[model samples]
Target: MNQAVRSEPGPVRQTRFSFGNPPRGSVAVVDTIEGIECCSEAIEDLAENAVHPNPFYEPWCFLPLLGASDRKRRLRLLLVHGTNDDGSGAHDTLIGFFPFEQKLLHPLCPVHCLCPWRDSYRWTLRRTPLLRSGAVANALATLGRWLVAERHAPKILVLDDLPGGSGIIDGVERWRAEDRRLCHVPDMHESHLYRRQTDAEAYFSRVLSGKRRRHLKRLRRLLEDLGPVRVADVDESEDIDRLLNEFIALESSQWKGKIGTSMASMPNGSEIAKAILKEAHRRKRLSLLTLRVGDRLVAARSAFLAHPGCFGFKMAYDEDPVYARCGPGFLLDQEGIVRLHDDGDLLGKDIEWLDSCAVEAAALPLSMRTEPLPLHRYVVAVRGGVSEIVSRRFHRVMQALPWRIRRMSAF
Candidate 1:
């Protein structure tokens, strides 16, 4: 194990270090956004002191899942720093990532944080306040400088949401070609940002236009006949798990007996959904959301809400034969949108239009359309031939597909 310890000059109370060389396998250094020590050390302190539930990236939580794979050479960890640190503590540790593979398939360079948390529709450092610190920025800049000096030649360095302070790194190229902005070292195609106007009323005004919205409204009125008609919007950390299961059930039903794919048809997808929600909730990010109707969970939607935009994740409704015509799924989404507007007022933040990840013309009628996140994939000489070829082919195919199909996909 190799260690690099960094301490503030005057106060010796805090010091940061990289514990081990991941390539060496015995021990690997976890990437800390604050550029401090790996999460293993920081999380220990938080777990011991904090009363709140452990965040998804908490060292004890991720280490076990990642430790075994450290030897594989594919693991890449980025840490998000929390506020507790002397500027060093649990909050001091930011993002942690592990790439599925090390090479980019296309002409572009493929450099992405293996462990990424989505903020807004894209990924960013402030998914949690801890990741938004100056320490994390210093660490990233230092790391980038070191890599450039060492001739690592990474084609791209994808910092999900660019966090803050990403522009200072030397030798890295920054691009803003797609839906969002990304910082990285240059390759064939420079990175680009995704920018689009989200007009919520324009998107959903259509839903309210036709009998579709009216029918659902009437369904609610009729449902009131069963009892008191009510629309409940839930956005709490503790309720994440239950809502997730409800989503899974709805998703599964949607795919039941289908030929190709459905949300519930896939294996372990449920677990993946929960993991993401848990992480997003832990960060207090706006990615997780759920809308329930009286007693029986009716609709569950997971989305990423950024300053000027929101990305819709999975949205499903419990299938009750009796209420099928009511379009529980669509109705819940309508209510969810309204709740978002209300929350925006409550929080005093701008309510940008919701991004459908991809355009679902169906959703367009409801208010969302397709918006793609700019992607700069990098391919290098050292990456295996097979991997590169496959990646390029995949990228090409995806780029060719229409937005609606992509929006329904769970990649």
Candidate 2:
């Protein structure tokens, strides 16, 4: 509702304004790394201020996805700009950047630009700075308005893997095209959250029950029987290259290797892995950890850190099935968590929490976690009034119908 209009000096003065978009504002789409690199300063600034930062959205990671995107489907890299009216003239400041793929409403449906598409992983959390110092809501509104103008607006825009307390949800609360959370525990989005407490014991107590603690201890003892096991943790950029290769090998040794889907297998997977890890390293946000039995690497955990919070991206183990019986993955996972806690601020960023980024079914080495990471799925419509009154009627009725009857009827 903050639609106050103000005057500007030059080309920006003629820029159209509506909804939360300011009068002196404009929008553009950037679908390439060259474009992103051009705005590196602004993009980096946004990353610094990003809420619940997701490295998947980083330029390097997206390089492959953009390349693999369907030619028929339009890839959108929406950039919102705010015009600053200095006495001399008007200048545009990069206020926001949103990336999404546009596709048909349905395979057979003639409608185009029904909404944005997400990948199979659902790593679509709010990585961009949704909570800017100011103009956050205005930036979103500008994007919304543009979607409407271009007929790219969906009746409902769904966002997957939204984290708890995300600013995106907060920003959309007041929009006529509102945001709503629909929680589901799909393996792709579900992850564990370990927040460090007083000490290791206390933290474990908070996350695990007495019985679970005993179980993990027994598993650790069995694993240690293999050999003298020790954890090596590093937040250093220099170690990422070697650590990355180790992780890929461990990951590929099992099903990932057989299926040729591991980071070391796919065409761009290695490049993406190297690029992201290297970038994360350069930004001083990389964490490479391993659990070794003598000189042999049994398990590896690598991630990208964002100050107090670290997001686990990959957890791989040497697959021998004997180690599986011994719980090698869990052992390393447990050590990695404790390493983050014990090392506390050694790197100047006190590890407060680790988003396990695990599938819900996988039992970690440390069964006792502070909390189950809440993963939320949500849908935001272009025009709330129209969606509620028109588009959602059929869905509402279908939902209301008896589940068994509907399934039997195949409706």
Model 2 — TM-score against the truth? 0.76
Residue 191 local lDDT, model 1 = 24
Task: Give the per-residue lDDT of model 1 (tens digit) for 304-345.
Answer: 544444455566665676655566666665565555555453
Backbone collisions counted per model = 58, 3
Best by TM-score: 2
- Which stretches of candidate 2 lie above 4 Å from their native place? 1-25, 31-33, 64-73, 83-91, 108-110, 113-133, 151-156, 176-190, 235-239, 343-348, 365-368, 384-411
Query: What does candidate 2's lDDT look like per residue over 139-211, in tens digits?
Result: 6666656655554344444445656665655555444334232111111245678887777667767767788
State the displacement of the C-alpha of residue 244, model 2, in Å, after optimal TM-score superposition: 2.1
The C-alpha lDDT values of all candidates are: 0.40, 0.57
